[model samples]
Target: MTERKEINVLNENVARIEQEQPIGISVLGPGAADWEFWLTSAGFKLANQEDADVILWVDPEAKDFPAIAKDPRCIVVGNSKTNALCQQKKITYVKDVNDGEGIQRQLEEFGRKTRETLENPTLAKSRSLTVPPALSPQRPEKKHGIRLQRGLIKRHLPPDAPLEDPKGELREEFREESGPLSRRKDIIAALPSLGEDERRLKQYIQEKSEGEYRVLEVAESYADLIRAAEKGFFEVILVHRELPGLERNLVENLKLLREKAPGTRIILIERQSDDFSAMYKGHLDVIDLEWQVIPELPGHLVSLLKGQYERQPENHVVFKWEDERKPVTSLPSVRTSVLSPALIAYHSAGGGVGKSTGATQMGFVFAEMGYKTLIIELDTEKPSLLRAVGAAEDCPGLAAWNHSDFISERTAIEAIRRTSRQVHGLYVLPVGPISPKKVVLPFHLEGLNGGEEENVDPCQQAAVFYSAALKEFQIVIVDTNNSCVDPPVFMALKMAKRVFYVMEATKVFLDSAEAHIEQAYDLGIQLSNYRIILNKCTANDLLSLRTITQTLEIPVSLQVPLDVEGYRLAAHQGKPYKPKTKKGISPWGEFCQNVLQDLEVPITTSQAKKPSLRNWLLGWKKKS
Candidate 1:
């Protein structure tokens, strides 16, 4: 019989066996113990061969073959060589003796055969299933176009088949033989809600484009359509107007798809009654053809989008939504209008001026006001931000960012989002487990810089980091090293919307402040953006506030008095310095509030506080 007829008979026999419950089975010969365990688990009860419905004769090629083959209930299972006796006797054979599935199928067949024999006893005595001559012990057995070795199947490749797939020629041959659209990269994704129309549209597009573009059937929802466009890199997307998300707002989702995949064209499919051309401003033509005329639509669309692709296989960038990162010969100037995240940089001309403390305190204040805030510690030499924030040092921060392949914006966002730990609504990312001498922020090393060491600039990487950080957070406060030559400080000063010049009221700090400001101005930081904070102020200081302002040429923003013991106490406790007092707010909080005012951020808290216990306990509550 042909393989197809055998498969059909096997399926019919299995279906017949499913109607009955577990049939009694008996085991004999070698491997009987293991077979008994498997048979019992398969819901077959053990019994003697005389009383059992079926006999599983394992290793029937042995001397016990004749004894088991005489029984009509026996199913011979093994790589048996019983001459021509078993075939002449008409016995059921299982070639792979150890295969559980094959054994189960043979058992089910026996069950059906026994049922049929009981229903018509004359049919069993008159005829028996004849084993094909090809399955005889003298002839080699073949199964499903593959040569059967002892009990296993082995495929033999053509003699001229290539051993290696160099240049992907072999893979291309396989793809070409598999289907017309198998190797096509330019996809045209269609939503599943198109129903029967989806098949017709796919056929039309394939007929018109001549298999240059493949139709990818995606999920029925608009959200999944966006994901398909993002990963599929399609040439065009067919979005149904009746999609679930479009009911909320059609224009918003179209704009989102445009942003997510600027390279792909979105063609909205709707009926003539549902017109959104005026709303979309004919940004792209909407497909409103009748059902009969849909075949002609693909021909015209194929011509218009023949070679125009927003993204290409060889011309892809790290950030598809943004332009490619070009090589820089000079320092990048800061953006004045669209400074994302309202970045504030805390810098000082020298150490021990409470720069980190000021940055932490300000971040805490912004976080308290319910703005998602992150404090990026750019001081790679001595990263004290983690210690001050009380988070563990063993974190994937700058070290992970440096070692990881942040080839796209999503990777950078996910790295920062997954690695950073939150503290009282404030997120703190450490420098790393082990502080490096310099942190390299190579976003896409090979693609952006062509794998050249000279192109791996720390300043450029800082810009990439900041660009991702802007999307993740609303308020970003950077704490930098004292040196102007440091990549973190220079980039922070240049990119920050507001820069706080933290220095003590001492003469040593005051004198160096002017030189640092001049160097920063030469580096593209405007002098107007500087907000000087006089830290560690003393009552008997020699330099007055007016003289200090004259020397620095920028007016002092705030004066924080000497608090060595208080700061030490806060540091020991591993928290920001927010003094608990009966008064409304502390001086540190007031300085943060002033900084917010400079940034033009509203000073409103997240939610109103509950009434105090004193108001309910006594009669001190205000009457409404």
Candidate 2:
């Protein structure tokens, strides 16, 4: 039977199954990009979905889908969940038949089988599916026509294999072909006395690029690859499984690339099957480019490219400013204007300073200003913002997880709720009570937690997890914890285009915040950041701000007085709290507006060097 006919029969069988049973279609993970891929490719229609008896569940991760199997009518699949289980010795599966003689072999075979299935109604409905090659790209092979044939492998694989045999022919083929057997044996029995003649594979390494095989080196670090990107190298970046000093800024590098190299294509390569794809799905055009171990060369170049890089092969075009080739290093040095710096940080200092309220309102301002925004409650322990906004929906975070029903672990982006606010583009993902014990980060790296100091370094850990996903949205606001000392808090802090130090109108608050600000600066944060917003200020705070600004020699960004009624109403409604009245700009709003103005690139004359408020105040005094 041909491959085409086989796939067709599968679709027909599925249709018949859905008609015969109470077929249900359930989504296991958040935003599986390829549901449409499977829906269209597999030839399933939604209108028919309601009537078709069987359930087709497209999950992002397969691990969360075990219970769905219990239904007997539903089949769940996602690369993440499926691959992880395969590694842990769960399911038995293979690819969609090998097309050794080009796609011609597979296509022809599919057509034949599909016709046979339709003609003979006796075939079992649950026919086995050959797994698609691994999600990672298959490496290229040398000089296409020739392939290594292990006779032992032939012994294990039957004419048309059915189910896997434990001690059967397949095991011997694996051992003899590339497993323990091959590694222990020498290349050939006949060779010169000298070792060079015997170590032929090593010789091929020197003349590597000349062979039909190709090299796929995953870049070592994000920074190294980003630096290479700044210089415009668009090849695959080699990344190491582990490294030091990589704990750096998140959005800054991506921001720089967007500014310098917009729409750059990045391919992620990992040493483990549990790679960083789903977590950073929206951020990259292709997440799992391919997978391989350290210091080991891949076997087939053709498989690697087809599996990975082929998905997104585009040459990027970056916007460049007109620069006359003149050395003006000594000319009055001026800074280039950049996009508005959005601040996404915990509002209150240590224990107080209105952290939740500050973040809550800032989220409102960002959305109102015509920017699509998403605010995640990284403040895992307190879980105030969700309740404050009535988004709590009366369920603990655990309530959202139908562990058995979910096929893949969904990201916060998947579980967010859209709010009914004037801010048309705002969305919220709230934090629930942290699992009493552990925090599971994206990419399955264990031991990172919040609500207190995190065990994993935030910036480094996030680079491995979050930063890649920032590409998906226009802007993402993270309402984090109060402890500036926490390394991972920098994970959110470093991603910020600007960081606001929210302090109360007291000498003590200012003093405490200065220390945190200093720590950020020392730990690779730029100093242009570090703006101060005095939250919940009173008349006394006005006096203190004045005295402190003069003593500290730093400008105060804004002064927001306490508004108990305005905040409490929205908090009770579980809606984002924003001032109803356009009522002359609160000091915080004005500061935010200024940031928006400054971020406008190629600063217009009117915007740069506008008369300072201090000067306007002086002029008013003179008039008086």
Candidate 3:
């Protein structure tokens, strides 16, 4: 009997080496999917055929070869006899496609050859397998080769000099260095502590430039930081992202620093694990250094001072219109229009569950009950709200948010009022018309154009939107991202008064739900705020309601049955599921009603009567 083996086990050494120097391989045709997990685990990036360092031809017996396969960099992996018969050279033959270890060894060897070929052409040419011709001749790109003309250089005095005032003559000769004093690039650092690490940083800088270029001061408090900034003409101000008091509002402090030190460049220093980029990364520089690599901070500062460091590219938002109108400086206080409006967020562990469906249906029911409701789409990855409502994706929605950092409560309400489409009486704030990949939440617009005020903190923006939304509507349903906990979803969880943890009534999804619920709690969301909503419950499902509730260790708030036909019918109409008769309510509606009663949400009478039979059938009535 043959021993069973786990496929695609990660090779740590290979993964580490690949991380240091990635190998871009393009796996072509048919069986490409088979190698994806293995390649990804081994830290190999899948690139396009044209840009790939190596081309992998999955189809062994293919007569018609892709144009890229003709390159010397292409490696054919298949049957030796078949490859030989096909007249291909430099083939890697693996007995079984499932043998991930064998494939890893071969690819590692090929990557070494590719690296050597680029490093030394003579060494690469002696080997049977060679890298692509284009990459083979060129050396690796220089990271820190360019050095700016900085600091001072001691000059060798000429043998002969003027007879009169030699010291004066020498002083006149080297006047350029003496004039303006050529300041030694002072720096002010504001870190969480001014302990041994801080002293060591100062010592390192002094040693690097002989005490000339060094940290002039270190601030331990927000007050000290602002004072340091205002007092010094420092070239660089390095502030910790999570500096004690600065955590409350980092951007506000950053702006203060920018104002205090006009020409000084501010750089935010953070721990490697921290990601403040999803928050405030506008026009400022940020560096994420490992805690162990704190000693290297001096070197990085020296490079910055020398103007040789390659800083991260700044994200610039270019507006479509040439209007030079300044953005809203600050958000206005939200006047209490509706007393404590219900803020509900719907989330799930994985996609393909009825998370969005549940949110929309609940919002629809609220709207029908004479409560003004707004369903905010927070699923940036793949927003389905617009499509679900039969509205054009190009309609103004989240795109309006790109305008300013501090959006007014009125502006938020106005943007939704003007851009949003209403179905029955439910208002939907749609995701903008663009590829989800290019869409950045909180801030950071990739290809989109806007004003200078871009990339505000996700939490800040969400707060702005939420406060604004609450002022206009009695019920705000936030349809969050499915599966992963992104920044938007995190903010949604924090902001929501009630969280609906939606999941399918299946073992696989139930397990996922348990994991996600734990994760939500780990992220500091209150367990008491969450309620499990079991969706797609079938009549003969293996697990009963009692079994599911017991398995998850949480009470199931609602168990929505599998209603594919009803969903399809609703989707076809670009609306939520409705009742068959005027006096009756759908199952989803009943679920919403029960939820409202449980939450103590007031249900008022609808202002408008049912549409005329002619209008209902023909849709002759115009939208309000």
Show where candidate 1 strays beyond 4 Å: 1-340, 403-408, 434-450, 580-585, 608-624
**lDDT score, residue 212, model 2?**
22
CA RMSD per model (angstroms): 25.8, 24.9, 27.9
Model 3 ranges with Cα > 4 A deviation:
1-336, 403-411, 434-438, 442-455, 579-585, 607-624
lDDT of 2 by residue, 1-624 (tens): 566766675566445433322112332344333243323222223334333333444332445456544443343333343445544644322222221123222322343343334444444344463222342233222111111122211222443342224543222222222321111111111001112221232233223322222111112234333332332212223232332112244223333433322222222233344444343334422222223332232233223423443432222311121223222122211111113334355545565456777777666555444344556565555666555643323323323422121221223222222111111124455544324543332322333254223343434544432342243234466676776545446666776766666677676876776676566668876656556777776765545666767654557777776777666765664444445343423454555568666545222111112235455344323321
Q: After superposition, how far is residue 202 of candidate 1 from its true place, in Å?
A: 42
Candidates sorted by lDDT, descending order?
3, 1, 2
- Displacement of residue 197 (Cα, Å) in model 2 is 60
- The model with the greater lDDT, 2 or 3, is 3
Candidate 3 overall lDDT versus native: 0.57
Error of 2 at 199 (Å): 57
Q: 181-292 in candidate 1: lDDT tens per residue? A: 1223244354324334544555455555555554543435665455444332344566656555554776656656654543344565543433544555454222211111
Per-residue lDDT of model 3, residues 281-353, tens digit only: 5423222111211222443555454554665322231112112322222322222246558888998876778
TM-score of each: 0.43, 0.36, 0.42
